[model samples]
Target: MLLACSGVLAAPTSVSAVSADGGSRITQVKVYPGSATVERTARVPAGARSLTIRCLSPQLDVQSLQVQADAHVRIGESSVKVQDRDLDKECATPLDDQVRDAEDRVASAKAETDSLELATSYLRTVATVPPSEPHSGPGTPGSASINGTTDTLRRSSQDLLLKLHQSKRRQEAAELALKELTEERNRIAGPKARTSTVTITLASDREGELRLSYQLRGPGWSPSYRAALDSTSGVVKFERLALVAQNTGEDWRNVQLALSTGQPTRSTAGRLPGPWTINVAPAEQFTTEIRAMPAPAPVAASKVTLMSMGDRGAETTPAMPNFDVQVSDDAYATEFTVPQRITVPSGGQRITLSLGSLDARAQLVSRTSPGVEPAAYLIAQLSALPGVWPAAPVALYRDGAYVGQGRLDNNSDELSRTGLSFGRDERVVVTAEPQQQNSGSAGFTGANVERKVQHAYRVESRHQRPIALQVLDAAPVSQNEQIDVVSQYDPLPADKAWNRRPGLILWSETLAPGSSLRFTAAHTLRYPKDARLQESK
Candidate 1:
């Protein structure tokens, strides 16, 4: 008697599943801008890492799913918004489902091929065996009949072999099915591992408030959030959480927590803030936290003055150019003039050109009448006063060259003997000296200026990999003049100067113009990423 075939008799199928069944059934869900949801049950095996449920109805479109450990939830029905009919054409089908289906088909085809091979081999061996004979040869009665039976058995065996060969040909057709399935799977699964993304964009506000927001998406699902508010004034401050969560689950539960509103730390809101921190936590696990409100920057106010003009002693009818000098926080000053054509033509005059207050801190610049464009001049009184020193060293750098310190000519004996001056069209920069005062100053520093002036050469390297470069000196060194070396790009404070010392090593007492000073700075050039997983350009 033949046994009836059951569904189980067809083939052995293994189902991989996700964990935890949901108490909620996501039915009739709609996303405002071209999004959809679908629900369906999946038969998943126990202790599986993940399980994807399929949508039964073609009318339903699924954008994403939320699966917890140990649960296989399916799409019941989906409500999708078709904003543009064009989008519907492109986003009409669920690509992920296609990929999964393709993978399954490929596996099934491989299994079929193996089974067919076995059957073909067994049939070939059977055909080669001679059929058993139940005949008494020679004088035995009905021996002729026994020979005929043998012949019939042999023909049947040959037919069976032919059928086995046909089955093998059928397996070849199955390969095409496998290939199609694989292509579909690839189309669905975009080539990258999913990760939670948090973007801290600085929003524009006249009040100088810091606004932050977050958005997240994953397999079978999508979610978004936004938070905005002003931070307090100081080196650092904290603010309240302000985030809104949206659920995009069909049959599974969707939960979200505002971990930290503005976490400035490497760890979660719970961790301490550091100089370097890159990652943020999931939005669902923590409350919105805003910390360390940065302080507002100070405005720079500077002033310049002409302290003295030598005694204008001359004939009663001496002549001078129209002198206009005005002094104020504004660029205002006063002017005076002596009648033209009168000259004493005697000893050099000592002019006391007082332009600034001794106690006030401000920048000073000047211009003289007759426009002779003095070859060199110095501020003697200003140099003597220590309070007037700029935050950074100020030098008369003209035409890519430094002025000699020996040329400083200061006549004022009040403050100090030191003085500063400039030639025609030359800039006398009273710059704040470059120094890592607090190790956290954001403004221009000495090291920063040095780095900018230093030459940079590109070195090719592998992406995301560390690279190192050796420093070498190629030029003679100097003493009166100074040279500093530095590297930019995730550089540490210690790396500011290599070997716990400055990068510079003096080649001589002075490095004149055209002298070459060389040092190597190593950096890795990142390679382009794999196109499949990257955001579409």
Candidate 2:
């Protein structure tokens, strides 16, 4: 972050010539989910004529570049130009010391390998000396002495070979380590590290600070939440975090980072409805016709119309969703200022930053739809969330143990409270009896069919304390006048439309320890025998 405030130029005369400067650094960054804005400031002495901020990444939106200075300093518009050479050496990752250490390790390993290889070669050379007319003395323990010497030489050769083999392996490993580190460092300083220099004409009567900021499309951050529930306290500890990353060929070192909910990269205006006009139509009729055109034109470059890439239609592939919940978040804009400075390395590597934490009022309830799932799920009904929270996946923990993942559905402008679901609770058992169905033809010579279905469910609580439980089920609704459906329950449900879901009924009560309850629903339908019904997911 040498760009934050790394330079101070000596006072120059009004006629001072323009020159590039490196004494500036990224001071602050406001990162949205898809784009980021970077601000750099530098100190300038009185009489300074112009300031040129050099080695800025080319990924920034040049049209968004702006220059601001003290009112005492008059400044002209800033212009950006692509630099002809490589990026500034300072723009690379701040891992030079690490890269050097890796290189040293490689060199040391190579040296050890070479030493071992030299010793092995020398051993081979000496082992071939050829006995040299051994003494020729009478009975000098002839054959035994020769065998002993051979054994010694063989043992020495084996040891040296082993040492050489191990040394080579170490050398290879060291080389690989060096390669990885070097590649990581170069990845941030590679060919895509093209840069641009922004020069802003200025005339200052006194010392002041020159600030330059621009919007970039590379860096982004997304909200991630952690919710931990303490059943005894009936409170959920909700923590906010952000996954931040960048690939702008520059490292963000301890910069003031702010996460904003505003979407500057999206369309600024709301979409207008196309049309709802209705028109009278003619009677349907089939018609066929054939039209032919001349399509033989070759070698006519002069008559060709030149068009840019923008003129061509582009096929954009839709992004794959992280979850099955297809929800559009249109909440009011909000911002979270990270309490501490953050650092995220370049190369799309993410680092999680903590935003803040708050406790939310929560109630734990066991709920189940026996027809859909035969087990009751533990749900945390939450209220009083932060002013605005975008829909995001939440990591759940109960009593310090990870429960599972949950979804936060408070992303709508009109919605406030959101419910979080934990995995099923086996302690609260649910049983759905077989559905009883009967059908028969009725109404004047079998003109219509009558069908009746009866569903029964039983729930039991094994908890030592009383717990609130909700049971839900949906009754069939007829869409056509020819079909008449009537639903009846053994005991009227507490809510006919549970959570605003039509046709879904809810049953609620505080179940005592080891207590059980039973409920039943019956539906009768009468419809034309030839009519068919379609099932929907």
> Best candidate, lDDT-wise?
2
Q: For each of the candidates, give the backbone clash count.
A: 74, 7
**lDDT tens per residue, model 2, 60-114:** 6988888888889898766777653233553444455677888898898889889
Candidate 1 ranges beyond 4 A from true positions: 1-132, 135-214, 217-500, 503-537
- Provide TM-scores for the models: 0.20, 0.76
lDDT of 1 by residue, 1-537 (tens): 000001101111254322333111222222111222322222233332322222121222223323222213221222223132122222223444555565565566667667766655654544444445343354223323344564775686677666656655665665676566545433322222111111111111111211111121211111111111111110111111111122221112221111111212113334344564445667776764546645544422211111112224434753454323222222321112211211111011111221122221212222111112222132222333331221222234323344432222222442222223323322211112122212221224322221122222212222132211222221212222232223343222223332233442211111222232222323221212221222111
Task: Give the true-structure RMSD of model 2.
Answer: 12.2
Clashes of 2: 7
